[model samples]
Target chain A: MRGVVMYTAGDVRVEERDDPKIVEPTDAIVKLTATCICGSDLWPYRGIEPADHQVMGHEYVGVVEEVGSEVKNVKVGDFVVGSFVISDNTCEICQAGFQSKCVHAEFVAQTIGTQAEKARIPHADGTLVATPGQPEPELIPSLLAASDVLGTGWYAAVAADAGPGKTVAVVGDGAVGLMAVLAAKQLGAERIIAMSRHPERQKLARYYGATDIVEERGEEGVAKIKELTGGLGAHSVVEAVGTQESFMQAVGATRGGGHLGYVGVNYDVKIPGIELFFAGIHTLGGPAPVRRFLPDLIQLIWDRKIDPGKVFDLTLPLEQAPEGYKAMDERRATKVILTF
Target chain B: MRGVVMYTAGDVRVEERDDPKIVEPTDAIVKLTATCICGSDLWPYRGIEPADHQVMGHEYVGVVEEVGSEVKNVKVGDFVVGSFVISDNTCEICQAGFQSKCVHAEFVAQTIGTQAEKARIPHADGTLVATPGQPEPELIPSLLAASDVLGTGWYAAVAADAGPGKTVAVVGDGAVGLMAVLAAKQLGAERIIAMSRHPERQKLARYYGATDIVEERGEEGVAKIKELTGGLGAHSVVEAVGTQESFMQAVGATRGGGHLGYVGVNYDVKIPGIELFFAGIHTLGGPAPVRRFLPDLIQLIWDRKIDPGKVFDLTLPLEQAPEGYKAMDERRATKVILTF
Candidate 1:
């Protein structure tokens, strides 16, 4: 088996590694059909987050090759999608729709990298959801998307309460931000604004149901959103970019008593209490509980109601994982799907 | 008219000041029946907030003496309880139930000090909620409580979603925190945990429906809450102390997907983004949209359904305003009511 590993910052390698086997009675061995590099991957790759011989990739979709004795929900020879964070799913937290904080939760990226031929999935019954049937080859990309990015964007929109009669503004042009535009639209938002400076990304944003596009960043971006919403800012604002400036801009772009859902894993950012105090908005965010929305999102994708696969502008073979990382890190690709 | 004025950190004096006059078409002149010292008033009294012979107090229950042409909801001779912040109520923000952030909002404490014999309330129709009729002597303190502390606490409980089947933890021993306990109980919370070290406050907390009292502070307090909640933390947490520790404690005490409502006016506090991000909870806070809850609060007080006035442990005449301030500043009184 071959897997992607990073020995140091800015260094990615795809080399032969031990084939993963079922480690727990509830675990299943999955032969990954497809996986991808994430914007979060850039954090470690760009040295913003540490990468010391770390396994790479959390987003994946695959066929179950083998299952342990305790795995009931999913069995061998079934196509499935799983959340980035493994959970028991039956815990009080997961039952409350916060599977990401499941009592037995584990970050799959740090333990079982999916950018490989095969990987062991713990708590398989709770973490993996099988499609209605084995999805067609054409539906693979969108199914893989339900693993993280799309699910994260959906969580952001839901957390922001983006629905009918509301204006939603997404602050980030990344894959997650673009997917948030689609989520807000699907949730019946009356208007969607995508904040992006790049012409290409802006075009993609429009394709994802963004009714307006603002190129400005920070204060100017917030002002633009406020101006478009009759000086009240948007009714719902999504923060998908994990930066100090982007976080504050998202906060400022929400109307008073509005909802601000931030999904960006901000690092080293200190939220000024005074500003947030005066803003007086409702806020909810974190590593999204993707498992909560997977079943529905998979249905939308399977029904072809949404074309989320278009987010993958670049694709590469599994062995070329390094180039995929480089392409995404250099901003030459919005998202790069890796083939098996 | 005589009013309470703060000449410096420890210097308070009742001095004769010009009588308030209606300035805006939306203004109304009210003869104050009662006023009280607030926890926030201590900020300037302690010099944490600057005060230069500044008029003090924002809470009031009074008789309307005069009204400008546009004041329709409130009229002369009407007994009223008004919010600390003046709002036009009909504005988009106010209509959204965030009157504290109304576009034309102004802090009454900063502009029109109710500690005076009379106050010129701006946006009278919006800020002042006329009681059903003239209140009996006993209901005066409770009606005044609705002006800020009681209303603020109610907003906190509402914001935190303290309702049936939820565990609510209040992280402050102030009047507002105690009121939050009462509000949580009224909201049908399954359990109410009031964090307090003072024995007297604990007794008051029990009277307000706190099922459990935790004497611990900081990490110990959070630990006690988690232990009581089966290691998952509370479903709703209210932060009524405006300090970095209290803010973080409230965040720590909320379970993933839980709600945190904060109302303490923090002077120098910075929220650590990483901690808040990973906490994955919902938070809403600020000066509180007291006007949004004033009517219901007034009704609750009117019907004697809630005894919020019990929070005022001391009383002083208008000329003894200096002693009232000193008592609160010295922690000798939970709250001090001023009479004519």
Candidate 2:
């Protein structure tokens, strides 16, 4: 199997690797149909997060090729979607809808990188959600989106409690932020604000049901959001960018008693307790329990209720994985999907 | 009028001061029946927080001596329980149950320092909750407790979602933390864990329905909580101390998907974004919206359903304000009630 690996910063290579087989009774081997490079992937690619010959890719949708004896929910020859972090849904945490922190959580990227021809999935019954039937080829991109970005955005919107009569502001124009706008819209938010300076992404955000767009960033951006929401800030704010600036912007753009949902993978962020205390808002975040939303997201995608796959602006063959990584790193593509 | 003022660290004195007069149409003059020294007061008293001859206290239960024309809910001669922070309660934030961040919020400590013979409570209709009737003398301390600590602890427990089938862990051993145990017990928590090293506070915690006590300070305390919760940590964590150590301990002691409610006046506390993000817990804190919970808390106290006044381990005349501060600072008292 050919898999993507980053040997160093700005170095992505697709190399032949040994095929994976089910080592555990609950495991299944999947033949990748679609996979993508994530915004988070750039952390390691740009050397912001350390990596040495690390396998790339966590988002994946595939066809189950085989399953070990104990695999129960998913079996051979089925189209399925799984989360970035594999989890045993039976754990106390998982049962509470936080599968990402499941007691037996296993990062698929660490053990079986999905940006490859074949990958092994552990705890298949708990991790993978199969479609009603083998999904049409056209549905691949959207299903793949549900594996991470869309699920993450959906969770962010949910955590922010974006619903009827609420004004939700998304503080990032990336795929996840754009998807959060769509999630908020789908969740019945009366108004959605997408804070973006990019015209192209702004257009997509509007298309995703954003009622307004604020090009300003930082304090100015927060001011614009507050102005838009009658000087009280938005009822719900979704933070998709993990930097300190983005975190503060999200906090600043939230109204008192509003919910601030941050799904960004934070780096070097230090939230001052005094400011947060006076902010008088509810904040909930972390690595999103993506698996918890997979079933609903998959159903929505299958029914064409949402087109989250629109986030993938660039698609490349597995052989062109390096370009896919480069295009996203340089901000030329919101997301890059690699076909196996 | 006489009021408590901190001239410098370790220097508290009851000094003659000008009488407070209604400045806002929403203000009311209240003759204090009881006032107390709070754990947070120690911040400035110990010189951890800056003070330049600042007036000392925010908690008080009093009789409404006079009311501005616009003060509707509270009338002259009414026995009233008011929040430390006066709010209009008509603002969007207040309407959303976050009166602490009300657009017209006025910190009583800064405006009409409660540790005095009388106070001018602004936004009286919103800030003051009238008792069913003038209470017996014995209820003064309990009503005073409701002005801050008890209400704050109740808000913390509510934020943590303490309820049936949940295990709640309180992180501080102060008045607020002990009250948090009571709140959790009242909220129907299946088990309550109180982290305390002092025998007196531990006994009070048990009296307030704490099912377990963990004397270990930091990491060890977290480990003990996890051990009690079958290795997953408590279902709800109340952080009544705002130090970095207490914040981290609260986060560490909560299970994934659990809630962490914090309400100590934060001083120089910084939450590491990375750890909080990966913790996968819900975090909600701030200066608690005590007014939002006042009516219910007052009713509970009036009916003798709960006795939060027991947290006041010392009573002193208003003239001995310095000794009250000293006793609390020396850890000789959990709380000090100063009778005017």
Candidate 3:
């Protein structure tokens, strides 16, 4: 089988690799139907993180080709979408809505990359949520979106406590951030602010129900948000960028007693304690427990309640995985979907 | 009127000052029955925080000698206890339960200097909670505790989400920390851990319902908490010390998806971003809006449901204010109460 591999930072290639097999009794072999490059993939691609002969990609919607005897929830020929992090959802932590930190969690595609033709999914019964039926080919991209970005964005909005009567601010214009706007809208936030400088991203943000857009960045961005919120800042803020500046902006953009839901994969950043304390913001975020929201997101997508697939501006064949990585890394595309 | 003033770091004096008078339509003049030195006062006394010719103390229980025409809720001759920060509890922020950040808030001791024979309280109707009736002289100390430390500790416990079936850990052993242990117990936390090295503080903590004591400091303290909680850390953590190390320890000792309520006045501390992001903790803390909880706390104190007055181990006449500050600064007393 052919798979995407990075021998070193900025050195990605599609190479022949061993076909993954059911290694654990709870594992399932997924025949890749669709997958995409996540914004987090840029971490290793930009030399910001360690990457040495590593498999790539963790977002996928696929058909189960084979399943171990212990896998009861899924079976061969079923279409399914699973979270980036595989979790045994029955654990105490998972039941408490922290599936990402489940004791038995394992990162899929770390070695047997999801970008490949086939991959082994551990804890299949708990990790994979099947589509109601065989989803239409047109719905594939949207279902794949629910596999990571949409689910992550929904989690961010929920964590930020965005709901009716809330004025929500989303920091970052990436796919996840834009999707968070959609999620906040779905959650009934009265006002939504999207902080973005990109005109294209801004348009999408508005379409996703952003009530306002702030073109400024950094302190100026926070100032604009405060100005729009009657000088109290937003009641809820979603941080979708992982850098120090964006994190601070998100923190600063929230009013006292507000909530900040952060989803950006933090890199090298130190949040000043005094500033955070003084801000008096309630915060909760991390690698989102996507598995917890997958079922609902899939239903919303299926009912056409949301169109998260619009984030995929470009698409390609599985063989062109490298180009997908390059396009997202260089900011030429919001996201890329690879169809097998 | 005589008030406690800090001429410089480590130098406190009781000196005659101009008597307070009604300065605003919402103001009231109170003859202090008692005022106490706080753990935060030691910050300036130890030179960790700068001190010039600043008036000292923020906690007080007193009799209302005069009320402005606009002060409707509180009347002259009413015995009351007021929060460290005076707030016009009618503001939107105050209505939302964040009275400390009310638009018309003034720090009591800092703005009006509560450690005086007579002090002016702004927004008297909203800032002060009157006791059931004029209290016996002996109840003054406990009522004074309700004004700040006790109410602040109760807020911390509530903010930390401590309750039945939860394990709570306290990361400071000052008067506020000991009081937090009591609050956590009153909130029905199943297991309460107090992290303290001082034997005296530990004894108070145990008496206040600390089920476990961790004498270790820093990383070891966190390790000890983990060891007691089956390696998952506490369900809730109350951080009453504002130092960077204590804040980090509180963060580290809380389980994933746990709550951390911090009440210590932060001075200078930088929190690493990745640690906070990955820890998956719900954090909420600051100068507690004691006004939000004063009515209930005063009721608890009045009913003999809790004895928070034990936190004050030293009492001195108003003329011995300097000695009261020194004793608390040197850790010779958990707290010092000065009588006029």
Candidate 4:
């Protein structure tokens, strides 16, 4: 099998790797039908995060090729979608809907790179959510997104308490941010504001349910949000970018007693205690517990209630994984889907 | 009128000052019945926070001496307890139960020091909660506690979602922390843990319903909390100290899906983004929106359901407010009350 790997910063390659196989009673071998590069993947590609032959992807929609004896819910020949974080969903944390921090959880990229032709999934029954049926080819990208970005955006919206009567502000123009706009809209936010400088992304954000687009960034962006909301700021804010500027903007754009849900993989960010304290808001952040939402999201996708796959602007063969990485690294694509 | 004033760092004096008079249509002048030195007051006295010729004190229970034309809920001769942050209570933020961040909010200490013969309270109808009747002198200290610490602790418990079946951990052993233990108990937390080093404070914490005590500080303290909660950490944590160590300990001692509520007046603290992001906890902080809880708190105090006044170990005449400040600054008193 050929999979994506990074030898060093900006040194991505598609090379031959050993095929995945079931190694534990709770494991399953998945033949990835689709996978994609993530915004966080750029962290290492830009030298901001260290990488030494690190396997590249975590999101995947696949068909189970083999299942171990203990994997009861999922079996071979099943079309499934799995979260980036594997969890034994029965654990206390997972049962409480924080599967991302599940007691027996592990990151898929750490054990089996999903960008490969085949990958081994641990805690198979709990981590993988089978679609009702084999999804249409065009729906593959959307299903892959449910593995991380879509579910993450959904969690962000839920954490921010986005619903009827809420004015939601999203900071960031990336895939996750756009998805968050969609989630907020789906969650019934009365108004959605997308902070974006790019006309293309701004258009997509509007298409996804953003009622307003603020082209400014940082303090100016926060001021614009306040101006739009009668000087009170938005009732909820989704921070999909993890920089200090983005975090502060999210916090600043939220009204007193509002919620700020941040999902970006934090880089070098520090929250000032005085400002955060005086801000008087609720904040919940971390890796999105995607597994918790997979069932409903998969149903939504299957029923055509949402088309989050539109986030994938570029598509390529798995062998062209390096080019897929390059497109996202250069900001030439919102997301790149790789089909095997 | 005589009021408490900080002439310099650690230098408190009771000096003659102009008597407060109603200045706003929503204002009322209150004759201080009881006032107390807060844990936060020690910040300036210890030189951690700057002090000049600043009027001191923000917590008080008093009798309404005069009312402006628009003061409706509270009137002359009414016994009332007011929050440290005076708010109009009708603003959207206040209506949403965040009076501390109310649009028309004002800090009592900045406008009219509470530790005085009489003080002017703005937004009288909103900031002051009148008792069912003139509270007995024996109830003065407890009513005074309602003005800040007790309300703050209640807010902390509420913010942390302390309720049946939850395990709550309190950081800091100050009056507020001890009060938080009491609040958690009243809020129905199944188990309450107080982290303290002082024997007296620990005893008070136990009396206030702390089911466990962890005397270790910093990482060791967090380790103990994890040990107590089956290595999963507490379900809810109250941070009553504003230092970085206390903040981090609160975050660290919370389970992945737990809640952290911090109400300490932050001095110099910065939350590292990466760790907090990965902590997977819901966090809410700020000055306590005490006004939101005053009605219920006052009712409880009036009904003799709680005795938060026990936290005030030292009582002095208003003329000896300086000594009260000294006692609190030197750690001789958990809280000091000054009576007229």
Candidate 5:
């Protein structure tokens, strides 16, 4: 089998690798149909996060090629979407809807490279959700997104409490941020503000339900959000960028007693306690429990209620995984889909 | 009139000062019935916070001495209990139950100290809640506790979502943390764990409703909490101390999908982003919006359903305020009350 791995920072390679087989009774062998490079993938590619022969993709939409005796939820020839974080989904944490932090949780990106012909999925019944049936050719991209990006963005909106009567502010214009705007609109936010400097991304943000756009960053951006919300910041804020400036801007943009949902945080960032204390808002974030929302999101995609696949601006074959990484690393593509 | 003032670190004095008079249409002059030294007061006295003849207290219960023309909610001779922070209550923030961050918010500790014969209170109608009538002499201390400590602890419990079937862990043993234990009990939490090393405080904690006591601090304390909760940590955690260790311990003691409500944050503590990001819990904290809880708290105190005044262990005449401060600073008293 062929798969992707990083020999070192900025060095992604697509090379022959031994094929994966069911290692446990709960495992299933997945023949990946589609996968993608993520904003988080850039962390290792840019050397901001260490990468030494590290396995790559965590998101995938695929067909079950083989299943162990105990794998009851998914079987051979079934189309499935799985969460980035593996979980049994029966633990107290997972049952509480925080599957990402399940007692048996493991990050797929750290253990399996899904940007390959095939991979082994553990806890198959709990982590993988089968679509109602085989998906249409056009729905593959959207189904792939349901594995991570779309579910994550939806979680961000839910955490931010973005709904009717809410004025939501999104800080970032990347794929996840744009997805968040889509989620906010779907969640019925009264007003949506996207902070982006790029005209192209800003246009897409508006297309996804952003009622206004601010081309500023940091303090100035917060001021603009306040100005738009009548001297009170937005009632809900989603932070999709990991930088210190972006985090603080998101914090400042949320009104007192509002909610702040953040994702994509960097290891180097440190939040001053005083600032958060004075801001006085409810905050909930971290690795999203994508599996919890996979069932609903897949249905939404299948019914054409949402088109999250539009976030994929570039596409390539699995053999060209290196180019996919490079494109995302250089910001040439908002997201890149890889076909096996 | 006489008031308590800190001349410098480790120096407190009771001296003659101008009697307060109504300054704004919404202002009211209150003759204090009782005032108490807070855990936060020790910060300035110990030189951790800057103090230069700073007027001293925030928590108080009193009789309304006078009111400006526009003051309607409270009037002269009415017994009242007021929040430490003044707010107009009509602002959006206040209406949303965050009166601490109201548009017209002002800290009484920063401006008019309440530890005096009489003090001027701004935003009288919004900041002060009148009791149904003059209270029995025995109720003065409990009513004073409602001004800050009791309200703050209640807010922490509410923010952490303490309720039936939840396991709550309190990270501080000060008056506020002890009050939090009481609050969690009243809020119907199934189990309450109080973390404290002091024998006396632990006894009081047990009396107030702590089902368990973990004398360990920092990481070990977190381990004890997890051990008690079947390795999942507590469902709700309250951080009543502001130090770095206490803050981190509070975070570590909360389960993945749990809630952490913090109060009394120091200015210098910086939370590492990676740690918080990985903790994956909901957080809501800051200076509590005491005014929002004033009415209910006053009612409870009036009905004698709770005895929050037991937190005050030392009582001294107004002229002996300096000694009261010394007792608290030297750890001889958990809390000190001052009287005219």
Candidate 6:
């Protein structure tokens, strides 16, 4: 089987690797139908995080090729969408919607990277949600989006309490941020402000339901959000960028008593306690419990109710995984879907 | 008029000061019936916060002596309980139940120290809640408690989402922490764990409805809470002490997807971003919007439903305000109520 692996920073390759197989009774082998590179992958790729011969990719929509004896819900030939953080949804934390912290959870990239011809999924019944059937070829990207980014963006929107009569401010222009605009709109937010400097991303943001765009960054961006929100700030702020500046901007752009749902994987950031306390913002974020929403999101994709797959501006063959990573890392593509 | 003044750190004096007069159309002058030293007061008193001939004291219950032309809800001769933070409830933030950050909000001590013969209260119609009548002499201590500590404790419990079927862990044993146990019980918390080592405070905690008492601190305290919650931390945690250790303990003692309502006046505390991000806790706290809950708290106090005032273990005359501060500073008393 061919799989994507990073031997070191700035070194990504697609090479022949041993095919994944069911090692546990609760595991299943999925024949990868679609997979994609994530913004988070850039962390290790840029040497910001430690990396040594690590298998890459966590987002995927695939067809189950084999199921262990204990697997009851999913069967071979079933099309499914799974979260980046595979969680045994039976844990108390998972039941409470913190599936990312599930007691029996594993990171896909660390165990069986989804960017391969076949991957082993643990806690098969608890982690994988089967779609209605094999989705249309065009719907593949949308289903794959549900595996991570779209679900994460939805979680950010929900955490921010975006809903009818509320104004939502998104703090990043990446796929997640643009998707958050769509989520906020779907949740009935009256106004969606996307803070993006890039014209290309800004166009996509507007297409995804952003009512306003602030080209400024940092304090200026917060000021624009406040100016648009009657100087009170947006009622809900989705922080899609993990940097301290973006987090602070999201916090600053939210009104007092408003919610800040941050999904940006924070890296080397220190949130000022005093500032956050005085800000009077209700904050809930972290690695999203993507599994909790995967079922609904899959249905939405199958029903063609949402086209989050549009985020994938480039597509490549599975053997071209390195190119996929390069495109996303270099900002040449918002997302790159790799066909197996 | 006479008032308590902190001319310098560790130096408190009862001195002659100008009697407060109506300063705004919505202001009222109140003749203080009672006032007390707060834990937060110790900050400035201990020289942690700046103090220079600053009028002290924010907690108070008093009789309205004069009302401005626009004051409609409060009248002269009416007994009232007011929050430490005065706010006009008509503001959007105030209406959202965060009166502490209201556009017209003013800190009581900064504007007109409540520990005085007469003090002017801004936003009289919104900041002051009138009692049924002149509070009986015996109710003064309790009514004064309602002015700050009790309300703050109640806010902590509410913010932590303490209610039926929930286990609540309190991370501070001060007056507010003890009062928080009472609030949790009244809010229908099934189990209340008071983290206290002081024998006297422990007794008071149990008296106020603490079902369990953990004598440990820090990691041990978190372990004890986890043991009590079947290897999971408490569903709700009340952080009444704003220190790095206490804050971390509160965070550690709360289960994933739990609420942490922190009311401690944070000072020089740096919360690690990674810890908070991975903890999966819902956190909300600040200078509590006590005014939002004052009416109900006052009604409960009036009906003798809960005796939060019992926290005042010592009493002193107005002239002995210095002694009250000393007693609290020395931990010789849980709280000291000064009477005129």
> Tens digits of per-residue lDDT for model 4 on A1-340?
8899899999889998998877899999999888988888888889998899998799998899999999999879999999999999998888889999888979887767788888899999989999999898878888899999999999999999999999999999899999999999999999999999999999999999999999998899989999999899999999998899999999999999999999975657988999999999999999999998999999999999999999999999988888888898888988998887
Candidate 3 local lDDT, A87-160, one digit each (tens): 99997778888898777877775655798888899999999999999998889999999989999999999999
Ten-residue region with minimum lDDT total, candidate 4 chain B = B264-273
Pairs with steric clashes in candidate 5: none
DockQ for candidate 5, C-alpha atoms? 0.86
- Name model 2 segments beyond 4 Å from true: none
Model 6 lDDT per residue over B1-340, tens place = 9999999999999999987878789899899888988998889889899999999889988889999999999999999999999889998889999998888878897868888888889899989999998777877888889889999999899989999999999999999999899999999999999999999999999999999999999999998999999887999999998888899999899887889998864657777767887777888877888899989998898899988889999989889988888898999998988888
Q: Could you tell me the TM-score of chain B in model 5?
A: 0.99
Model 5 residue B304 CA deviation (Å) reads 1.6
lDDT score of residue A266 within candidate 4: 62
lDDT of 5 at A65: 97
Tens digits of per-residue lDDT for model 1, A225-245 = 989999999999999987889
Candidate 1 per-residue lDDT over residues B250-286, each given as its tens digit: 9999999999999975768989898999899999988
Tens digit of lDDT per residue, candidate 3, span B222-314?
999989988878989999888889988999998877899998646568777888877888889778889999998888888888989999999
The 10 consecutive residues of candidate 3 chain B with the worst lDDT sum are B264-273
Q: Tens digits of per-residue lDDT for model 5 on B133-221? A: 99998999889999999999999999898999999999999999999999999999999999999999999999999999999999999
Candidate 5 chain B worst ten-residue window by lDDT:
B263-272
Pairs in steric clash, model 3:
none
Ranking by DockQ: 5, 4, 2, 1, 3, 6
Q: How high a TM-score does candidate 3 get?
A: 0.98
Clashing pairs in 6: none
lDDT of 6 at A135: 82
